[model samples]
Target: MPDNFGRYFVNAIVAGLVGRIIGVVKTEYERAKVETAAKLKGIGIGVGLLVAAAAIGFFLLGVLITAAILGLATVWPAWLAALTVGGAMLLIILILAGIGASMIKKNKDLTPQQSIDNIKAALPLVD
Candidate 1:
């Protein structure tokens, strides 16, 4: 009888531990899901900005081509206008790049430090 009782007690202890472990895992999963969504959104926005900058760069290429053709003409004013537009396009590209750089930089550190802390709090090391 005593042997049977001891086995049942151990089973009960194991069952409770498994339930707590499952709870902790579930909580961490949900937290990670939310965090990942936010991070991905930020990354998507940054990528979109970069893509727009590339498109504008291509457009600048066309403008440069036009400017080169214009330079072949006899007016200094046309060359001046081309340089002005080119300068403006370069500035725009720089601004977009800066914004995208900051965004990507912000998202680069994706370690779940908060999750780590929570797990540690939930299950402290025995040592």
Candidate 2:
């Protein structure tokens, strides 16, 4: 009976260690999932707000262009005033689009490179 005591003790220790490890892994996974969901929600809200702001800005711009056309109509023909306003708006749009495209081209990954570097640094330790 005493000879089996050591075997039972080792088995118990191994089981406990595995159980603890599984518990820790499950907790960390749940935490990561919740955090990721929260971050995605925040990003969605931010994008929605930005799109709303852009829509409002465009509406204001349209109003201002109409006002400009009306103001210019007092001096020139209505058609010429409209054409001038449209041409200026087109020029502004082109310039802004070029800048936006260049910025997009220069953009990097959204994920943090530092975190990836840290993970890489830790991987060698595992071996």
Tens digits of per-residue lDDT, candidate 2, 1-127, equal: 8879989999999999778656655665565566556555555555554455455558557756776867666766665556566666656555555554444443322444444444445444422
lDDT of 1 at 87: 80
Q: Return the clash pairs for model 1, or none.
A: none
Q: List per-prediction Cα lDDT, in the order shown.
A: 0.81, 0.58
Q: Candidate 2, which ten residues in sequence have the lowest lDDT sum? A: 104-113
- Using all chains and alpha carbons, the TM-scores for the candidates as numbered come to 0.75, 0.56
Candidate that would win on lDDT: 1
- Residue-wise C-alpha lDDT for candidate 1, range 1-127, written one tens digit per residue: 9999999999999999889877886897778777777777787788888888888999898888878888888478887799689889978988997898788878766666566667678867511
